[model samples]
Target chain A: MSHPNRLNINVENLAIGYKDRVICQNIDLKLASGELCAIVGVNGVGKSTLVRTLGNLQPKMNGEIQIAGENLGAFNMDQLAKILSVVLTEQPASKNLRVQELIALGRQPYTNWIGTLTQEDKRYIQTNLKAFLLEDLKQRKCHELSDGQLQRVLIARAAAQDTPVVLLDEPTTHLDLYHKVQILKMLQQLAHQSKKTIVFTTHEIDLAIQLCDKILILDGKTNPFGTPSDLIKQKHFEQLFPSDMVQFDSSSGSFKVKK
Target chain B: MGSQRSYSFVFAIIVLALLLAFLLNVSSGSVNIPFTAVLSGMFGGHMEVESWNYILWNYRMPKAFSSILVGGGLSLSGLLMQTLFRNPLAGPFVLGISSGASLGAALLLMGTSMITGFTVMPFLNDVSLVIAASLGSFLVLLVVLLVANRIKDTMALLIIGLMFGSITSAIVSVLAYFTTAENLQRFVFWSFGSVGNLSSRQVALMGAIVGLGVLLSIVSIKRLNAFLLGENYAQSLGISLKRSRLTIIIATGILAGGVTAFAGPIAFVGLAVPHLTRQIFDTMEHRILIPAVFLYGAILMLLCDVIAQLPNSANILPINAITSLVGAPVVIWLLVRKRKMLF
Candidate 1:
């Protein structure tokens, strides 16, 4: 859409945590526009926390996180909202909303005080509804949708916001394997076609390696960041977990269960 | 998601229901005032019976207006709280506004006599009672707001409000134990919660307060909708949590507190009206819920008032009892039929 390689996010030695306790540090990332990236790690390795910090949803404990050369903390919430949209995993349940209505909420940043959707705003919602294949379920209440459908509604809502960047926490946690690939592929399409910088935290390391343009592995130590093949070449995934339980297969770019 | 019918159509139905309920409420009182008399008396036409005209203007009109303001304000605040807390069970009184009013009324009716050992309070009247209740609710709301500022968690604030309720209720109980039987009986009667007994001036004041509260809520539609998804997402979507949350809490306080001040803690209507409105509208959008609840609450209050009046009889039931009796069953029936609560 815009110049594809323009850097959208830059994080250097970023430390993220709640209050004084730092959860993840020495985290480094530089995501250009039109990139789909994943942060994959062991449980409690602060994958979600780092994503939250990057989204500016919470305060960072240390280091610098900049979006397009501006400090993450420099922008007020309104400005930040225009720049980034989030689909949090722990997002409180709002099953009462209809699919169309939830998607329409993505246009809130540009709407009037009463949140009246403009023609352009309505256009964005329609585009997202179609793009995400949610047109058929647009009239259905979100409670009626399966987990895969609901995640689509939430991501479409973020895309409808038309922000430059989107951060999602575990977008495919509850979906089946096929749905997981479907969502990842849609996200890949969104990044390449719409030129939005997309980042998500996920436990799907295999999918992340296969589909994501880049992957950040938080091993509770190095927290390596690079191209998936580069990280694989660097042996970053080998030490990701207890080798006694699961072994990292570098050639195949996936982890295998130990027998 | 929107209702299949146009909002205009739904609004027309709501307006018709409101008018019918208002007329039914006005006509069926202790005295059997005919519908024709109500219409003539309200309009430019002359009433054949002079006393009927006086009753219409002086009593029924003021009482009916009180019902609308009290009902509408309380229900609107209930919707606000439900959205703010993101909890289905949350309502206007969850913040201790009503308990504060009860404490204020109790202190005036019985605590004064208990402390001074004087059997009479010469300055006591309906106006003073209202002032006392207003002061009490205002004080508790102030404390709650201050605490809310310091605490980031909403459930914690709810617990604090409940603690305030427990504290005020305990004080009221102590006053009840110490006061004489006459003072206690007066306190009990005041606690019954009437939409009558308010003078024209008092009703006007209540109307102004409810109007201001409604206007504040109307402008807050964006924040209300954001809050439906809970605070984190709301914050992400450009809502400054501290500022938005405070304004909503203050609006709810003015509404629930002002209504409780005038009407003495009317029950079940606040807790049930939003849920009922959702059943009909089948949407979470505040643009619709605010007006829908306002209309439904007014109509329900008017109907409950008519039943409480116990037409053509000297005896009257407490409005608090009538609201609970009518509201509780409908909610039960709705839940039973759906086999699920509207989340």
Candidate 2:
């Protein structure tokens, strides 16, 4: 496709990694506003790293990220929070905190010194609670909630943040298939309704292919990104699973075994 | 869903309970001042005008006010640390600040010929203790921060704090072993915690430190809330994890330090009050949680002080003894409940 218009993200020659170990380098990428993107890769191939870097969750090496033509570092915490929100995979250790209380944390950027939720902020929080089907569990403590409920609660928190970009890492992990589909559908609706850029990393390539507007593929080696169709056409998935037992079927755009 | 009215109703009840507790605190001392006398004294009148005035002005008033300040400070600090560290058990004492103050107090009591000699003012002997406590609290906080930068896990940080407390306790034990019996008795008395020992000026200074710390914590409520999501998530929300962490430690220092300096290491208020507030408020939003914690802590400390005066003659119990009598049962209950959850 032609270069997507309204691209708000620009990363140049980026290198990202964890402590003492570089995951990926020499990366150049751009993300358009309102685009729904899924990052797909084999295990340990740096898909999460790249998405984290783009989310400004991790520091970039030897390059810079520009969001809406402004450098990422130029935005202070509150300023950046107004633009981007992130949901991590780890559950918060705050067991006694309730669902609604956790969601209100998203409105932290908008609160004053004492962190009181404004009426409008409360309205937004309520909307997310209902949208996420968390109204019944509003008073339930986080530890009492199941993993699926916790995931939804966190997603609701990100929604309450009202940012233009929302990034999640493995939002579907620890979820059953039914809840997984529900979460993906919610994210899809979010991207369309809020016109927010939604970026997430997942291993469910078939589900991503069916749900995501675009898919960024990373093999164990070169070429860390591509659309689902493009990666299939390029045959990048052949080496991803490491075993010849599974084949990347082109017709149905799904994975199947040779058994 | 419960109506907003219910939330406000709960809040109103908490406020009323706090007021009642404050009144009881002002009236239920050894002198058995009447409610009317306490109220009138609060509004600039003295009932007896002899010992009532002396007792109200020189004794109970400052003691009660300091209790309120220290109670609020300790619990608020506990709430901040709990959120910042993302651990439910994190508190000022758990992080070694209280022990640090205890160590400082031990040093001051044992190191000198006279405890009052270190102060700038002769009349304000406890002034030296307050300064010494603040210094020690800050020193531990600095160490905790340095170690925190290296240690990433919340559980590990809690352990580090516990280890620090143990080390301080060991040092205090060694000092106690070397000191004279009279000095040791004084140190031991200070260790058991008391709310009535602070003079008027010392109370004022304690108020100033605690007020400053609590005000700082209030200002950082947004940051603290962000912290509940973990440090990385907080950082993404535009809060610097380092800055938020430091603010929490300093707030904790003032709370634990001031209390230990004057009250001599009050137990369980920091550990118990935050959890009590969380349950009472039914929400973890710091705006609600902080105030709830403050009120609950004030009530708890006051209740302990009241019980400490149970003898009513010359046999006032140590505040720590009363708190442990109350707090130990609650802790055991929590443990039992947690064990029941395992099934």
Candidate 3:
């Protein structure tokens, strides 16, 4: 923890979208180790695109990304894999994989050529299996896990990678409230305990406000980034939705529907 | 760890089964050779009947080796395709490699006769057929590899393969339509699929190509496991999509195409063996599955060849018919009993 304040992710003037189209622009973020951040916005505001761009899974329309003080483009896939890991919203292609087998894939970067796990790799897997409360379900097939359990498994895999930065897209889309908080709280603890930078796109704005150390509210314009209290004082959340149907109350930090 | 410990036991059983199947295949031909003579002859000892020794060395043994290559190669490629495309239904020929082989074979068999109303190429032989089919499959695979480079979606690439299959099969049908009866019969028999046609040299070449394919697959083992999580996740794990996809496509071509070149299209062996191996291995790690599926496929093919040879009977059955008859029911029973296919 000597470099606990090290800059983990640096983004400046980033624009993300598919070819011939721009989804969002002028996005800027600066995060350090031991912090959990959330990207929050209304639907179609390009939250997932930004997350994918940061992970280099999707190309950025314009701007620069730096991870651990190195240009994102300078690293090859193998080097990038050692430094970062990504989790998408979609389930893995093969659900028949055992839970431990699915999570152990995160160690591919450090394993031997034929992928025989070393003793160090096995220790990482065992720690994550216990950290995610997945020891009982380790032998179960992924298809047999509940949505919350699977989400935990995916996040646990990213944790198992032991990377300095991890990015996820909508890690709690289909979970109930208790599971949603459970996932977010686990991510928060993972960030603080491992001193790793964690970023995720999510829809639970109130929960994000409660758990995240910092929040980026993508509004397709300025795309502001700040602490929850600073963003709340700036009225960023109030501008998120149309005023006619819903309202963001600053004191309570939750949205209210019109009667 | 428990799974890892039990793999040795499962592999030992499969190796034993393969040996038994090989013995059954080499001894059960229509010549009515004694088991003892077959064994001693195989080991370079003298036999009571010299003809039986000739048959064992020159015919049955070669045919059995051909089956090993055909089955092991096809099943390994099928497993690669299944993992590459993330589709459980994918087979070795899903990329249209076999259809291209069929098209090449059809043109050589019937095109010469239909063009001039006579079998002008009287000097034609098996070499010409093998070359034609190999060239056809590689040509189609090259085009598929190019399309794969352009697009990132795997499902679209699979559809393009299906389109290629349709286009090639349509050309084959047209050739079949205008050809003479003798030419048509040759093409039909080729489609019936036989592993008993290879000489020692062709079997050696097939072995070399299959060895190369298996070696590449072994090098790709880590990436193949990465792909089970899909492409984006694989890339995040440091697997280059373009390189891995191209490598897989070329390796599949080498395998399925080489088999079809010597022994027409052998069905059921490729698509079914991987699934069957999974039913026993119960794991998705490619390191364990690759060799397991190959041996299982080899065993299944040897048994199918034995059944096709029909002990003491002069009538030999088409291997394709026997494979389907034997493989489809076992797969169906496994699926029904398990209540789901273990893709």
Q: Compared with the true structure, what per-residue lDDT tens digits does model 1 show for residues B236-304? A: 789888888768877777788778777888877877899889878878888988999999999889988
Write the candidate numbers in order of decreasing lDDT.
3, 1, 2
TM-score of chain B of each: 0.86, 0.87, 0.87
Candidate 2 residue-wise lDDT, A1-259, digit = tens: 1123566667777777887677777666667766778877777778778767777777776577887668988988778888888888777756666788788888878877767668988998899999999999998878889888999999998888888778899999888889999999999898877777788989878888888877766653465465677877887777677566888888899889878
TM-score of each: 0.93, 0.90, 0.94
True contacts kept of each: 0.59, 0.58, 0.72
What local lDDT does model 3 show for residue B177? 91
Clashing pairs in 3: none
- Model 2's DockQ score: 0.48
**CAPRI category for model 3:** medium
Model 3: what is its DockQ? 0.63
- Better model by TM-score: candidate 1 vs candidate 3: 3
- What is the lDDT for B41 in model 1? 86
**Model 3 over residues B164-270: C-alpha lDDT tens digits?**
88998899889989988888897898888998977888788889888988999999998999999988899999889989887887778778877787778777677
Q: Write the per-residue lDDT of candidate 3 for residues A86-146, one digit (tens) a residue.
A: 8898789899988899889999888888888888888999999999999999999888999
